[model samples]
Target chain A: MSKNYSDLNLIVRSLLPENQETPISFLPEDHLQTDLFFRRNHFTYPSLTNSSYWLPIVGAVHTPILFSFKDLVQMPSHTVKVVLECAGNKRNLFKPKVFGEQWEKGALSMGRWKGVSLKTLLNVTGLKHDATEVVAEGYDYGNRTDIDHTFSYMRSLPIEKALHPDTIIAYAYNDKPIPFKHGFPLRLIVPQWYAMASVKWIKQIRIINKKFHGPFQSIDYVYYPQKESDAGAYPVTYNRVNSIIQQPLNREVLDTGLHIIKGIAWTGKGTISKVELSVDHGETWIRAVIDRPYNANYEWINWSYEWEISKKGEYTLMAKATDSFNRTQPPEAMWNRKGYGYNAIDTVVIKIE
Target chain B: MSKNYSDLNLIVRSLLPENQETPISFLPEDHLQTDLFFRRNHFTYPSLTNSSYWLPIVGAVHTPILFSFKDLVQMPSHTVKVVLECAGNKRNLFKPKVFGEQWEKGALSMGRWKGVSLKTLLNVTGLKHDATEVVAEGYDYGNRTDIDHTFSYMRSLPIEKALHPDTIIAYAYNDKPIPFKHGFPLRLIVPQWYAMASVKWIKQIRIINKKFHGPFQSIDYVYYPQKESDAGAYPVTYNRVNSIIQQPLNREVLDTGLHIIKGIAWTGKGTISKVELSVDHGETWIRAVIDRPYNANYEWINWSYEWEISKKGEYTLMAKATDSFNRTQPPEAMWNRKGYGYNAIDTVVIKIE
Candidate 1:
């Protein structure tokens, strides 16, 4: 781990295929610095690369384009401080247990990603009319228990999401070259979706005509609603409206006094309209004040409840976020066999002595 | 609704099939009186009958026997106070969502059950050596979305569980005949398991030579561990360790002062050794004082935390029951595709004004 990356107290979830979680409560920051961000890898790290690394855009396009890191940076740049949360970030919290990486709540991070807009690249590459999806393949490759043969970490986005201005071929993190641990030369940043759609280690891209059914799209990362059949299952896309209490970590002992309960809330559908905190178990909700400036699509909004307590005892804290779409988190998380999109009301118990 | 049952403030989950839940918080007694007990029915009420109802024990027995209510009452009497919770009591709280009744957390109540031990009846019938399971069929029959043919509510118990002394064919609630709304003539009380195994309004039972695969046994009460397939799934059996705070309703606001945090806790495999209260997200657990007088198997133990709060704001109250088997309630309910046995840590948010 780089000195810059390891010092942030990022908890290492796994080793072979590196997976690290940001100690979200430890970093008291609005947005993560590139070095303080979390890292998730599906396979062994790929060979490091410099800015001259070439990215090939192939298949179904009128003309394929080979853009080196230098060439991409030469184009007009766009920067977005977007939040990327792994679809399985809260898998461990689901009942009955779900398969794959057992992330708690921090396989998520926000960064000022600077890159060439994917639409700009698609325009330059001149995709054919039949193109339906943009597939990005990473340099890391390995075999998983779900599949037999070795395969690269790959994901695809629908034509519209791919062309959205917020979608970019990210090459810089916080105005600096992307860290080697986080897809060195270039990465595809598909905002408003789970980080899986933000394919890293950009080796090549494919403009495909069909709904891509690669392992990542067809078999894995698919949300199976019920247990017995796959008939109504769909690809795991878009982050559900979610929020978490970062202040006063669960079970933290506090004294009777004024305390600030703070956390972050986000959604893929629309801007977070408001966040509500419940010191009482969901009976009456007190609207939390959102730090309004960062209410953008694909970005998380910071929220805080200034709790001035006169009673010294145990308190349960529950946080729920509502999106501009008027959707509020449910008391219970939606049940999916795979444990994806868990947006239940976030709860924590605190003791005041 | 019977004045006896309705006066207790039962919430109607449905009308035609007659599913009613006890407003558990409203009752202060250790065990429910016959009039205050909850009622869960899967079909229209069967023809109500007075004593003289005949229960037939047939199949895989030396001699099938039919016993009348008088005959049952004449047998050596046994009385046990047991708690019966619907397997889907907390189904509404499961993630990804589940099917069947959208029950919250109140489809459970305890009562003084009086009846002849099922073993006593089976002993008279003399189960054949090949008997593998005992299938109980309720008189009520209905068509459901998953089944084409109208079928009687049926479930089975393995030979071992069927012969357990605690398993009784109850005909009396409290000291009187079972209420017509509950089961009337006969209700199988499979103590320690989800109420589903306690088939109500029982008409007959069959000692089967092989595993029972009735709709209720095979399709409904079975636990599907994952959404993909039913490979390692098993029948919903014993109730897992669970607890819930009752005194302070979720989000109930109160003044800062000395307050009692009261709740009930139970488990199937063993005694609820202790119920711990967590006010801090889960950082520190304080053992609760359980009323030892009723810590019987299949029975719930009432517990209380004497919390005196000096400062007020919001408090999250969490109750976790730990059984003598060394198992403690999990923070997350186990994942079951069908949403069975949800025993996650019970959390309630209370506000201290």
Candidate 2:
């Protein structure tokens, strides 16, 4: 049975229900439940058959290659633990609140993905010198108010991001076949960018001589700064620094005494350098102990701080993260028309009795 | 009519309302309106008589002196514009929401004060070599739950801060007699610390032989870091870095066009080195234009950023300030039980339609 997209009541809906949010508190575990991984689809699931399928490669190439699923897996396969977050995560917190799924930091999840490296596939197909962009298109089609006609979900990446060794065309998740709701037989995973860049139900790869101007590429997912014309807007790329408080949820009443505060921090640009906590409404901050043994370049790090509370009153708990590149989460998330990349400091209020 | 203390539903009310908030947007001006200046009192306003009144100078002094107001103004009065902010400003933003007035950035103001330097008064009284702290007492009296017995509002400062040239006993505000509500006749002004350190309606000054242990000084306004017991909390001092966006208040809707975003930035530690704006949800940031001619070592500097909006959508505007000492506003304010010294980056969201 097909699900009605209207039933989801998502903040942003073009093709499929923007469902799937990971229960982040269960993290620090080696593998996330396959059902709990975030799923962002641009179209309804396409019907599948036992017949073999091929991925077509066209444009700016000396010779285009149409490789079957068997052909991709025959080449050396690589496995990686990657975390994916919707660009619009935490969009509900924006003042005046932007449009899209009003996600409150749950639109993210981690998975152990098994895939064939894009670089390996690129090495097999000879590319022309002028090929500057790699356009990836999905088979799903949908109507978008931002564009004129029904179009398939498609996006393009620069040659550098496309050729990155970590970029992959995946066939399995958590050592199992990719779930039908998540993309079925195949999907593209661009580890660093927002989940939107990792096209789902991917069908064709086209190498272009110049920047691609698809609606999703040019008009949508672009950064329109205040007063700047849309023509000059920059395309959204890497994720910013962000952190979340997992223990003692907001407004949780507790006894006036010592308590342990904990949370997780992550960023797409670099490793988290430090995490800090503020228990007295941002009057003074102290460093939190980050669990370093399980830290990974792409996975979130767990951190904790012990706080002693003798006074019975309300307290606002806050967490901030700084990346190795000296980039820190902003006190407030930057605002974009599409609500992309909202990574402000995380806050939660609780009462002590 | 005397107002009963119970009538005031204040977050931090004991002997007095503990109420005072500067109208921040009217700042950077040469003189703030007398009515708009923040007024924090620890007790009911004490009626003043024209008959000879003296400010008693006692404790660790070779010769105790009772100098009248006339004697203070006679010592070459100096006038300066200094900004005073309640240390607990923006305390409401902390997660768990700590106690004290849930101030949202309006507990500060600038005033042109006419007074005699504390150093001049100290020189006349002849401080003993053992004198290490100067405790200032206000005439207003009240009961206390934090301590035993009815105590006058009193706070002590280290000799260094007490003897600083900027520290003064002010006789007038804005070239006029100080209003009754705002410490009429005379008040102590400690230029750099939070308003609580500046005792209001002053009547006595006592130089101590050692560190003072008054309720307000050693207990109330102290910093208690995560691991520290209440007994080990540090006394609150010097204000932290802070900024505010006065124009285009949060959630303001405007037409899609060019608009100038303006605000004020100030720090007690040093001059503002830079101010940056992020309109793309902090994915990228650019330097804002700081109004330079009005810049003063002790006053806030006005800043403006030109934003051109061509897209009709929601946007979150953020501002981050850095000081000459390399201290930047944290992504989240530090938290203290008293909710003091919140200096997180300022953020606002608006819709362009």
Candidate 3:
């Protein structure tokens, strides 16, 4: 099959600067520009133009159902302002540098996704009692170097994560039909884990008794600290507490005076409990004002720090975040072979002159 | 035509950490392992299994010559230890996060390249008086979205840069024949410019009387700031003064005592004049000891700082470099659409207990 690769360059070109802190900045008033949303696809985008689309449910279930997209839309729909980041976001920062698409911080984006809770969808299928895992498969298939067999993009989550209340089978993004590059007809949105767990262009869901061993699940997105050893490799999950400077951009030269440094902090595990800014490097940190309270568990919160620069020289600025669980952004992420989940404290060097 | 893409994953796996400062750290003793050397190829690697190889010299030359590799070897040869970094090495750190292969710090590697100086090679062919530019073309060709025509990978440099004494037509790396993925028969080594100017699998050199307009020369690698306009875009050139932390890895936990923080620093414009370290973020800085004298213009020198920590707390550490021209690493590199030449001071966070 001739597959059309998504124009990744266009996706990158459409992104607002990472310092902007909000993708909604580019959203137009009349329409939710689907193209502006950051997208990550494992395979070429599949062409689906049929008026009626069906999602197949297979594996450990007694009654496999082919639910139409129209049916999925009619099911109880919930909207979420979820922040989805490719597991490989900030992968380029890994010490040895990992393989896969070398995404920078732009691999993350926030979108208003409207869909039915995966739990509600699962209730229709009636999972077998022995099921321990649910494997979601996308229609796109391709040959990847890491695996010997050609396969479709597939990933699985433990039954618990799959059934989480926030996990959804998204039908629309930003109040519009999901764009083709972003899994058109249907896509799974795993709220807590990195985006890879959220299969795109989903065609099949298989509830299995044992753990899934698909290529994307076992070989590709794994975190192997000791490059060659798969023995210690584990599936990457959950977003780490992280923050990004949105204003007074990295090397932005500032007049020697008062300026407010602003940014956004987020975590998938819990609410952002505190954000600290260090303008004098890391020796001393001042608590930044979190602009908004943690209203949603999946969205980011904006924060700002006021600094009065009295000297004329270069300065290193840094930001660190701690989640409600006392999980703070580490100075360094554990070195993994795939360079996944790098949530080290963010630093920006700014000049005050 | 068949094209063999370099297994980038394998190359990344083969690289020692950037802190190691040398790619050959993992090499075996018996042979100079060229494959282990870090590689960055714009297109698929070309095959040149023929025993005899010829390099074509064209454009603006009165006597265009097809010099055989054998003839080139007879000329005076020089070996230089050069540290080559991708222009986009730290592109991931750029504020807006430009598109391309998001390279981390590992995009840089040091190598002993042996070959004849490009100036000496150019002397054989009489240059036309009006010649102002030299275009180098590699055998690899590919389809790129930015350009309309399918073309070979080509780039141009001003005649002055092309004739620099350090510029060479390299045939060997680490005293061994260049590997297939690393431009097997011959490659251009532009010492001062980022590695993109040092084209691999080189086949032809054209001395043009005017500026070159190839896709790579005019568009692909250009630094287009603001994303919307190319009017201010300029071809990327010259490596910026930069440094990296080699020890006390990011987020590394230290035992309450004395520890040595070490790293390497270099610049393409001039020798590294000073390296400063800030253990307490950026409040106060201490000059680090440059371990070696600045003996070579193209190689990096090691530096280290001593720290005595008695308290249990998290600390942010950063390193800044200044070059001989009194040019110091900026708090950030100028923002460009391609995200090239980011030379911000490097920082690492560590915890002490």
Best by TM-score: 3
Query: Interface root-mean-square deviation for each candidate?
Result: 27.4, 17.6, 16.3
Please give, for every candidate in the order listed, the TM-score of chain B alone compared with the true chain B: 0.94, 0.90, 0.89
Total clashes for model 1: 33
Clashes of each: 33, 31, 9
Which candidate wins on DockQ? 3
Off by over 4 Å in 2: A1-353, B1-20, B23-31, B293-295
Candidate 2's residue-wise lDDT over B15-95, tens digit each?
A: 134354543542333436565565555556665665677899999888899998889878978776777888777876776
**Model 3, span B1-353: residue lDDT tens:** 22111211122211111111112212222323344444565544555667878898988888899989998889899887787888877765777655455455657777778888888878889888998998889988865544446889898989998888778899988878876667768989898688889888888999999778888877767777767667777778888899888676565445677898888888988888899999888888999998664456888778888888788777889899999988787766788876788889898777675
Runs with alpha carbons beyond 4 Å of true place in candidate 1: A1-8, A48-52, B1-353
- lDDT score, candidate 3, position B247: 70
Instruction: Flag regions of model 3 displaced more than 4 Å.
Output: A1-33, B1-353
Name the weakest run of 10 consecutive residues (lDDT summed) in model 1 chain B. Answer: B1-10
**Whole-model lDDT, model 3:** 0.73
> DockQ score of candidate 2?
0.01
Query: Candidate 3 chain A, which ten residues in sequence have the lowest lDDT sum?
Result: A13-22
